[model samples]
Target: MNTPEPAYTPINCDYYDRLEAWATMRTVCLLKFYDEEGKEHEVSAVIKDLYVLNKAEYLLADNGLVIRLDRLIAVNNIPVPQSC
Candidate 1:
């Protein structure tokens, strides 16, 4: 059975803007986030795209990883606020 996705916690607008800027500039960033099972992961890749799917926002990385915005812990050492 497919597991239901966790409720998306909207990120701060300023952080979202930063992500957009990075994607536009193709900047390589260190991304830290939690996976479906709540495992922490880190990767360095350029942001390729940002899109919404099924009402959840996600970012695609140059390395072909798609991460939900709510799952992100930090980008480039900048911590993502827990509250929206």
Candidate 2:
């Protein structure tokens, strides 16, 4: 049986803006986030795009990783706030 995806929590507006900026500038960043199994992972990649899918927001990395906005832990050492 397939497990349902966790409910999407909206991230901070400022962080969202930063992600957009990074995507626009093609700035490589260290992205820290949790996976479906709640395992933490990190990657250094440029943000390629930000888009919405099925009422959830996501960021695409140049390395071909797509991370849900709410799963992000940090971007370049700046922590993602728990509250939006």
Candidate 3:
């Protein structure tokens, strides 16, 4: 019998923060966050703004709607953030 090692992928919080900042500046961008069950979700929006941290989850805003970051998985590439 052979044993396998566990793989790992580091998550970059700074990258996420940059993406969030870009989105807030009206820069078109996507966001991916983890959900309660550790599910990945891709959300598309201008990433309006960073919702202040709530009691349980990292708050996010998209197209005027607020959602928890944990509920996201992967954000597809989007045009660079730009001022409207």
Candidate 4:
């Protein structure tokens, strides 16, 4: 027996998306915040040196400190950010 997951967990969603050329340079990411309820969240971490391809799944790692993007759901290309 084990505890069930909450209805909603707060995890910051940050990832790159669909791009023909920059596909190999993009990555999916997630971050947990202190304000989050239950003090826990689910999110994928940065991939290793190897470029993360499509259809990768994420697994919890580093004592839950980090989440790895082993599988990807979807990719969307957004404009890169620029400094002021």
Q: Model 4 over residues 10-72: C-alpha lDDT tens digits?
A: 112333222222324434543332221234344444433323223332333323442333222
Answer with 1 or 3, whichever has the higher lDDT.
1
Taking the tens digit of each residue's C-alpha lDDT, what string does model 2 give over 1-84?
989887888998888988899999999999999998999999999999999999999999998999999999999999998655
Flag regions of model 2 displaced more than 4 Å: none
Let me know the TM-score candidate 1 reaches against the reference structure.
Answer: 0.93
What lDDT would candidate 2 get against the real structure? 0.92
The lDDT values for all models are 0.93, 0.92, 0.51, 0.32
lDDT of 3 by residue, 4-73 (tens): 4223232356655665667767766566655445565666667665544424234445556555543444
Whose lDDT is higher: candidate 2's or candidate 4's?
A: 2
Name the candidate that leads on lDDT: 1
Model 1 residue pairs with clashes: none
Query: How many collisions per candidate?
Result: 0, 0, 8, 10
- Where model 1 places Cα greater than 4 Å from the true spot, the runs are none
Best by TM-score: 2
- Looking at model 2, residue 39 earns an lDDT score of 100
Residues 9-49, candidate 1, lDDT per residue (tens digit)? 88998889999999999999999999899999999999999
Q: Is candidate 1 or candidate 2 better by TM-score?
A: 2
Task: State, as a TM-score between 0 and 1, how close model 4 is to the true structure.
Answer: 0.21
List TM-score per model, in order: 0.93, 0.95, 0.46, 0.21
